[model samples]
Target: MSSLPAPTRRSLLGGAGALGVAGALGGAVAAPAHAGPWTPARFKGAKLLAAPDRHLVGRFSYGLTPALAAQVRRRGGARRWFEWQLAPGRIPDPAVGSLRTWWSGLDRGAQELWSRQTSEIEYGWAVMEDYQRYVLLRRTRGQHQVLEVMTEFWENHLHVPVNGDAQFTHRVPYGDLVRRHALGTYEDLLRETITHPAMLVYLNQAVSTKRRPNENLARELLELHTVGRGRFTEDDVKSSARILTGWSVDLWRTWRASYQPEQHWTGPVRVMGFHDANAAADGRELTHRYLRYLARHPATAQRIARKLACKFVRDDPPQSLVDHLAGVYLAHDTAIKPVLRALVAHRAFRASAGLKVKDPGEDAVSTYRALRVAIARPPEGERGEQYAANAILWQTAALGTTPFEWPRADGQPVDSASWSSPSRMIASFELHYTMSGGWWPTAGTGYRRPGQWLPRRRIRFDVLVDHLCQQLLGRRSTATLLKACSEAVGVGRREVITREHDLVRWSMPRLLTTLLDSPYHLRK
Candidate 1:
């Protein structure tokens, strides 16, 4: 097959920002409230994939990729590959290193971000953009796919956004907090997030004091963070507030959190079955004890398990599965790996194929991986990134969601229902069409710049269609799918069709876009 030409920087910058998808949505756009982590979607012509090859790639990673599928097969199957992913320390993430080229100050502290000496600027927009791109790259191309997937889930679970410079300064380290315990125990994860300056500031814990105990952090801790619901009362909220007092940020010292006994309320605090005395000044130790207790609570286990089940298994997970997963969570003392291992091993996970509809971010990542796009990193100041990033960001926004961009603490939904609207689906079709046509790739997809829709081997149109289906979907092209591709370029007979250059060239975008737009590719 011939290689496509690289888009010039001029063409890339010239409205590549829209990805050629501006105002291309169909019907009415759905409101932000329509989607969530558990929304159900009804996909048209969704593939019923019985093969574990596709299932594993879909479950553990963003979507099915040939490279990922081969890795799974190389590891002896899905389970072994999943086991390999569980220990990310064993995974060599060379792709993660390129992050510095695009996003600087990932290693800097709040002081650097506050100062002019570093790329960590006082403007929160820069940090937000860099971090968002960082998230996009890691999610799209990181070798530690499971870890990235889990980290995304946990980051959303412990949702914190950088809307302003103060938020940017503190929330810069939030991703680290999520990564540090991405596969560790939930107790550790909870304690780390709650103690972090970003969460403290975001949840108003930094301002909580003996005189004015803000219950925001305490409320979310019991209501959303830990126990989840009906298990904690207003008294618990008020008491937890007093316990969380003095967890203040040291602005003079890079916004590091420091416990102050002076601000802590002195008294015996009882939250549910746990009891601890402030000892007038030992609020830090007392708080830690309370947190551990909360983390170990059965309710917390059930809450986390239900969420996991919903994420990995199904939209509305069965009570049996939720209970079973909850036991797995508690049996291992809230250690994440065991619960996740048992989850994959569970019958529900194995049975779920094409069950999940991809979110906007997931769809975008899947498209990039499907096309085998080489992640671009030009000079520090470049137009390609601006145009490409704007396009991606807008597409994600149009889907009504993006990583860490959820304004609320609740985070973006994981269900398909929230993202199955006509408008979003049409936007996806337009985006994929643009990509398949090689319009947005300023250089091209993959290490071999100037991407091609046609395979290297000279094959017939029918064979080409079949090859594309396998390449993109890991399955053979159905008659319906083949007809959709062939007819797009006015090919009459399937058998009589030959290697017609112009027809194939014309059919490339239509065929590729149709395949990607199919419900099969939309679900994972």
Candidate 2:
């Protein structure tokens, strides 16, 4: 195997410190302070705090949904609701037949047969559409919120470029790797990802040989996957790459053991301060030992804890809480369920408010979930198929979070600063308006009847506002918003009213546009 260049202190510092002032600020703010243990009495019957509610919904659920908000109120508070979400298997599965059918319809073999040649780009787009559809169904279906959230988290953690040739064909395996193991043991998930064909191709490990080792996969395996920054050296990365030599894809070929002894690195390698001392050891054994070491490292525990806390608790989670979760992770040998349990039970998790920003995926899925929109079945004709594809692709693009197509391996940032860009904000407003208006393109087979498309009777302004507030905002609208909506609906001409039969048809789009673009929506 090729030897690694020794890590320089300067290079380490440059890479580690690139996190900049934001990292320092996050670290400082995340320090624990002396707060008495939480007492339920303090929060009982208190006015619902907007900030905490927003954070709670953003993290535990898809985003804030009016039905979820009301359910929280009925159940007493966020703590109980969070506890339920952490143990997602306890909830029954909602009907997801439509979602499953949508996925099944995208089989590459069928598509290739029809198109006469396989376009990797087209296949990637189809898989991404299925992913978006599934996410939307998960939110709206209501029973699998926790599973969906965990799936998203794990997918980001083990990110593979979707555009690669092998990854394009094996997208199903990549997705299945995440979904099946999302809530299982963290170690298992990490190990599975290491040999997965998608990852091998995406990180250029497929061609990593003893003579000319590629360090891309090794670098990310530590920097992004296990220890994150400062915990491993460049020398360690190089050594790790050497140890991982001989791992290659069985693309389009039957999966026999792909490890070629002749191709393997039978040379000494040092990694993370330990030498593989047995230079001529079996390749499989060497790979297993290396992965086990990474999975069990203290740095791995810390990194995983911080990420979980950030996703479920706050933007900058309390160090004490993270430490506690890390301890749990270690004690359980990186079992995900126990760590999740500890996170849900922590006091900091319940108290932090307005700390997370809804990624576009979260925002779009949560809205559909709140509205109880079912994934529509494909119609009988070519027009129907085109419409279904177009609608899903357009919505995904509009939200700026088309699945499997993130610009970076880090996945889309979950901070408001990234998502609230001017163009993004405009897109959010437009999507909300379109959804609220029930304005599906009429040139398709999935078209709704007039009654389904828009309500027949005139909806009272006050009642309409209340329903929307309860459904979309999860709280009653402010008096100013209510007054404006009432004025807008009351002044429209009969011709206009007839043209837009539903109150939602006429007013909801404008109202939702305002709400989604509001500072309140941006905060959590």
Candidate 3:
């Protein structure tokens, strides 16, 4: 079958940039001087998003949903809300509780998961696809948004893609492990992630033996996971490889993971300041010590601080904020929560609101959240359309990135420009329009009806526009937005809109699309 036609590059750019609206919206749009008393009196003090709250919620969560915005207010403010989110265990998460049961493949043991693929009962790619859907649903609906955001961050940082041929069976388990340590200390997280079977197999450490130690895992441990580059030498890498020789998995067979002491290379090893004597056949203790040293290294602290700042603060984070966070990381013994608290409390993070562009996964999930789309569980067999849990995975892929499917070990890029390309923006525009219209993935999902958007039976078009802006974008409406919305529906700003109006009957999608297509919705 022929595919849907894509927009021409010129048309896409023109569609967004032609309206001095999005370009002007990209910068702060001064709230309409005379537009006021718009919010319903009941929700004014409770749900109104102040500038600071919007920035905090937008920066941390996938996107600010109405429920989340209210929660931030009920909990006091952004700082208090963030503090509440820090301890994820205290947060009740019923959304993903049954995900493993829905996608039964996720609960299978490594042996069974591997056997199913080898016996052709199920494809490895299909199993991984379920994992992606599971993640998308969780991001869209989970109450513990901070945990989800940080899990994605560390999963990318110490990535073992579900597509890895040797690591597919262990991939889901690796993701679970990452989530467990996502809010914990970096030392514990690094140790657990590096020693996991998925990491070993993905980096070729499963095959590394006393006779021939592979340097792939070791080099990446320094360059990507821990100290980053320039702090360690070739000799450090070789020694690091030798130190991590015993952790192995039964590859291409049972998929069982075990520590084989005999396969370990026995020799004195030194990497940076970490040193161990050549004595024991079991090097697990030595490996743990080395990873702890690396995790606590000043360079590792700097690298982790800068990466966190860049992802949450801005594309190019300030050095002062990075330095402050690095000090917090060390002072707290690499605890993640303290570093996060320090980062958010810093002036740089507060000032960097609405500056970072959402990556593909963020964009898709946030759109779902903003639209208040309800995704139902898929049936036991095939999934698509009504099976929105599965269909949403492809939605993200069409946006140009699929979760954990980043080809290289470096994982997906987090910077703004990486996702700000014309093609990506056009793809996002198509997604906004399609979802706004409730066109695809119709089954097992519920899009808010046009009539439900009415605050009351009769309201002014501009007031309604302001309500959408506040509800969806976490801010009040700007004059440009009012004009765009009016133009989008071919109505006057002062015109009264009712359920019987044409704008509510058939042109609602166009109006919603105008807001979703704005830079206010695109940038966090």
Off by over 4 Å in 1: 1-50, 116-122, 251-254, 382-384, 387-391, 441-451, 493-500
Model 3 C-alpha lDDT per residue in residues 1-524, reported as the tens digit of each score: 11314323322332244344335224444344554433222213235778888888888899987899889988999899999999999999887788777787887888898788889998788889889988888888888888999999999999998886678889999999999999999999999999999999999999999999999999999999988889999999999999999999999888889999999999789898888895899999988888899999999999999999889988788899999999999999999999999988899988887678889999899999888998887887654435778888898999898999999989888777788776787788889888888998798889999888888898877778877777777776665566566656667766788999988988788778778888777888
Best by lDDT: 3
Give TM per candidate.
0.86, 0.76, 0.93
Q: What are the runs in model 3 whose C-alpha is more than 4 Å off?
A: 1-46, 383-386
Candidate 2 vs candidate 3: the TM-score winner is: 3
Error of 2 at 163 (Å): 2.6
Computed on alpha carbons, the lDDT of every model, listed in order, comes to 0.71, 0.60, 0.83
Q: Rank the candidates by lDDT, best first.
A: 3, 1, 2
lDDT of 2 by residue, 1-524 (tens): 11324323222221112222232112222222232221001101223436555556557666666556666777567767666666666766656544566555344542342242253334455554555655555555655566777887888778875544445555555776787788888888898888776787778787788888899898999898898888888889888888888887654443222665566777678877567764664587788778888887889999899988877676777899989999999999888888987886788976755455566776666555544444555554455555533465567567676655675666655444566455665565566556555564334323223234223254434444544554455555444334334333432211222335554444445544444433334334
Positional deviation of residue 445's Cα in model 3 after best superposition, in angstroms: 0.9
Clashes of each: 10, 1, 1
Q: Please, what are the lDDT tens digits per residue for candidate 1 over residues 238-306?
A: 888988898997653466678888888888888888877667675887888889999989998888888
Question: What TM-score should be assigned to candidate 2?
Answer: 0.76
Q: After superposition, how far is residue 427 of candidate 2 from its true place, in Å?
A: 0.9
**Which structure is stronger by TM-score: 1 or 2?**
1
